[model samples]
Target chain A: MNVLVYGAGQLAQMMYLAGAPLNLNVLAVDVANKTVVHPVEKTVLPQSLEQAINDADVLTVEFEHVPEELLLVAEESGKLSPNLQSILVGADRVREKHLLESLNIANCEHEIITDIAQLDGICERLGEKIIFKSSRDGYDGYGQWRSSTAADLPELKNIFTKLDLHKVPIVAEKMCPFTRELSLLGARNESGEIVVYPLAQNTHHEGQLHTSIAPAPLLSEALQAQALDIFTRLAEKLEYVGVLAVELFEHDGVLLVNELAPRVHNSGHWSMHGADTCQFENHLRAVCALPLGSTEHGPAAAMINIIGCNTFSKNFLSISGVHFHWYGKTVREKRKMGHINVTANSYADLADKFGNLSEYLPMEFFPKLLADADRIK
Target chain B: MNVLVYGAGQLAQMMYLAGAPLNLNVLAVDVANKTVVHPVEKTVLPQSLEQAINDADVLTVEFEHVPEELLLVAEESGKLSPNLQSILVGADRVREKHLLESLNIANCEHEIITDIAQLDGICERLGEKIIFKSSRDGYDGYGQWRSSTAADLPELKNIFTKLDLHKVPIVAEKMCPFTRELSLLGARNESGEIVVYPLAQNTHHEGQLHTSIAPAPLLSEALQAQALDIFTRLAEKLEYVGVLAVELFEHDGVLLVNELAPRVHNSGHWSMHGADTCQFENHLRAVCALPLGSTEHGPAAAMINIIGCNTFSKNFLSISGVHFHWYGKTVREKRKMGHINVTANSYADLADKFGNLSEYLPMEFFPKLLADADRIK
Candidate 1:
């Protein structure tokens, strides 16, 4: 069996590992070069984009930001997953909000701002503080604007005045005081058989995910079920296959959808070693119309992202229950270097063992910083 | 972190998976090639064999057949695990019998046949039914002679007369009836932490394993404890690091050691998905002087081997909860092609699922014809 993954990134590399043992040949398309190559085979081939797509049993994307024309071509060939509609909604915040509203799913209340007047109306209807976001090219805290007070709204709106509203619309949402952030990673097969992994509690720094703990320290069973329900409804509505990670905000025991990532997610990285079958392998199975895998969690798992560092100690090599994954990228600059997964018999034990991991991490960016910054507590 | 593995095969490939993530570089030196390479990086560079030994934090093997010279080098390096004494015993039937006899471990009572005329004397000291085996280069029912009747002894003697018995001595032992075959996959770290996975009931045909069932159905707790005790003693006695698989034979209420593999064994493959930390990952951790991983089992799992034959249906792809792993080897008659792992809520459920597996298998060489195989009861 052959599969054509639309993007050449870490996720595609991981998917290659999961696909290789099953004798599934995966060709990663470097869209920038329009050349197809096998990651493990390391073969550079002279195949046209159309020919590659036609040869694949299925076509999928690693990220949502693929060229729309290529996606249209894939859809025409009857191989694209989650469909163009789902990708469009995920790509555009306005369409995402509309879809959630149409499905009666509870999300952060927001307004679509196409003009300065629309921003004023949104502020009048909502509150003094809001988050203004560009409809496209935004991730990891980029392409965003913030209004902390009513006095700041006019200035923020003025900055967007020169842009075409239709081409670059702004979405303003109410800022909620949430208790915690959680994510649900689940997979829905073509037959609608959905399996949800244990909810994960994620901690972020500077809008970038630094760590995630599985089974979420101390979440209520009720809240976990509610989160699963939200993800299930979204997957069914989208007619989705493969893994879906739904990021949620917990405010006063109530869960609200923050965003949805319709592919293998960072929050699910622990599943690679902490679950019966990893999310990547299972996602491949789901997309290929194969059987779904068990979603049971391991004893306890914690995954730490190794970001912005090129070199690390070989000492970590001797750490117990530690598994390292390095993306074979040559250059590294705040690019997600790789990840470290640690599993233990108990959550506290795992935390205790990995608590001092950052200290051992080569501090290229902030040398001699206080030890507290390196601690996991 | 650096590690030296003795054999380079699929198990080494998997241990590579566990080590690659932690930046723990494992150098596997194939006895045949005398060449070492990183399985994940897939890079080949030359280093002094002794230098590779010196670089490792700890040393272990994928199998026990590593040449004695290499074992001595690692032992002299102070990193060889399971010790050279134990490995030598594992590699040669002569030392194995001597060690077993010294430890008072029960086995097929035998006499060393250094001369052809000794067969009659050996038969008299042992029993009427006897099995003869070469001291080295014997595995999977190869390089052995079986004598079930007196009529066979003359032919066996004549065959041995054609060769030099002094150069290649053989062990002749009494044959005993066994109720079933079983194995224990266990681990020991330098710190003396010991973990034993559930005993597996194995079925082999022509000496090659065909299937393995975890928690062997209807097994008594006493039997399980006996197996664990035997493994613990062997590990401690050898000062073993990394995983060890002890194959045994059950004759009535007593279990006797059949052979010992001082590394990851095929019977333990189910642990890749059935346990919290797979044997490959745990083996690396154990050898690297890291904490051992949990040996907890999943609900239930059964792994079936896919031996030689390239024409099997991909339909196993349709079975939910089934995982297929194919080794990338040039196809050959009776070679290990791949395996399929089936997991379910219960063993009965897994057996039921195995019923449909034949549909995806190459039926020509299937053990039973369809009519007889259909009768599961």
Candidate 2:
């Protein structure tokens, strides 16, 4: 079967790799250039995007922010998986929050602010400390504003006015005092068969994902059940197909929905080495309506992002279980160039290898690893 | 760095898949058309083979049978790994045998026969039971003949005459009574760092590899040492870089070298899932002069080739540890369409999963699995 993926980026490149062994032809559309690039070979050839999409048996997206016009064209073909609605919900923070609230799912207290005037009463109602995120086109902490205290609200209001918050609006959320961040990745097929990956503990740096560890060490059954429950409710409610990542905040023992990513996610990259089947492959399988593979986890696994740096020595492979995945992209500041996934027989072994990995990478890129090393030990 | 692979076949496709995550551009040249095909995308675009070769930082081959002219060009560029001589030795049975003997590696008693008359006294000289293989362009069970008894010699001689055996010549070997077939895959970098995967027990059907189990069940340390010793000697002698697979025959307690594959071999497919570093990635690493990854094996693993069939249900993935690799080839008689690799915490778990996989595959293609089920139990 052939699959056409919207957005020719690293995720698409990875999906292309995972699909090859499954006998699936994965083609990527360069949304920016209106051309197609071979995900693995990266060869820009003379082929019309329309012709490629017309030839594909299935259409999917690697990122939620795919152009709406392209998505409408794919939707007309009736091949797009997880549907346009699900992707739209993931793209717009306001819609996502509304969907969660409709299902009575536990989520951070928030209000949609379309006008600067609406921001006046938001802090009084929710809290003084809040994070304001663009309802659309926001990622990696971009298009976001934070109010540390009531004193900072007027300054934030002024900035919002300058940015014309009336058009795009902003999701003002009361910052929850969560102990740690976690993400749950789940795949649902057209047949409604759902499989969820183990919860992964995630750490972010400068608003970008820095590291993730699967089976989230010291996780309790109660917390896992809560996260999976939230994932299932959202997946079934949306009639979702393919992989969906729900970023959550673990506040005390309860889990609250933080955001949703309607695609294979970076936090689940460890599954490439740590699970029986990875999220990329599973996502493809789901989109193609193939039987989902097992989501069984290995003993212990961690993924460290190779952000904005491609100069790390390939000598990192000398460290056992360290599997490097360079995205074959030109390095840019704060961009995810690639990632490294490491698996071990035990948590202690994973920690030891991760510690060794920290030594190989620049300290600036591995703050999460440096901090987690001690906790893991 | 870019890698130009000489053959655009399944092995090259796999190499392409493995290299993408390493930030390496892996391009394949179609020797017949003198064009380049993206391995994952399979797009036959307009590009000159010479231009691709010129753009590549390193040049390698997916098989040993690359045309001599291309090898000469790559050798002239000083970018070929394993070098032209090593590949040439791998392609020619006579040269391979000579090299083995020069290294004093234990091998089946053999002689080079150029004429039918040379085969006259070979049966008497070597033994009654023997096998004849073409000196070049042989793979799987093709270009091979076997004699069961002394009475069969005249018919074999007649067949060889019809086949014009004198042109390519043949290597006649006394068949060794062996307990089982085993293979060792090892990689040597340009910097002289070598790492070897665990020995794998291989089973063949009608001379085509059917299945392979790694860390070869009940393996003795002495046998592993012997296999590694032979591999090191051959690799060092050839000054080989990249992965080399040595097929061996376990006769009584001794391991006899059966053949050498200068590139990745079918028996090492299990490494895709069973080893910390797969043969394809390590091969790329060695060729690119990057540090070789560890060769640590998972507890137990098995790989079954999906030969001449693509009709098997992908539902087999529901079985834990079952990983399918479809080569994206048009199915044809005796063609290796794809393979499945499975790993488990123990041999018994692997055996159980293998047994389950056999049920999902056609009986015609899985005789080895059926037989192994009982042995594993």
Best by DockQ: 2
Here, model 1's chain A TM-score works out at 0.93
How far off is residue A139 in model 1, in Å? 10
Deviating ranges (above 4 Å) for candidate 2: A41-45, A115-117, A138-142, A160-167, B115-121, B138-142, B158-167
Best candidate, TM-score: 2
Error of 1 at A103 (Å): 3.0
Retained native contacts per candidate, as fractions? 0.47, 0.85
TM-scores for every candidate against the unseen true structure: 0.82, 0.94
Please give, for residues A1-377, the per-residue lDDT of candidate 1 as tens digits.
67888778778878878886777666787777767875533346678887999899988877877777777888898887767777777777888888789888888888887776787566677787798888777333337878878899777766777667777677888987797788999988888888888988787766777677787877678988898889888989999888888888888889888888878889889888777678888788778877688777765787777778767654564455676777756656667878878776676666665645645776544232222223323
Q: How close is candidate 2 to the true structure, as a TM-score?
A: 0.94
Docking class of 2: medium
Model 2 C-alpha lDDT per residue in residues A1-377, reported as the tens digit of each score: 88989988889988988998988888888888878877765666567998888789999999999888888998899999979999999999988989999999999999888877888777789898899889998433338878888999878877777766556778989999999999999899999988999899998888999889898988888888888889889999999999999999988788899999999999999999888789999999899988898888877899999888777677778887788888777889888888989988888888898888877888776778868766677
lDDT of each: 0.75, 0.87
The global Cα lDDT (0 to 1) of model 2 is: 0.87
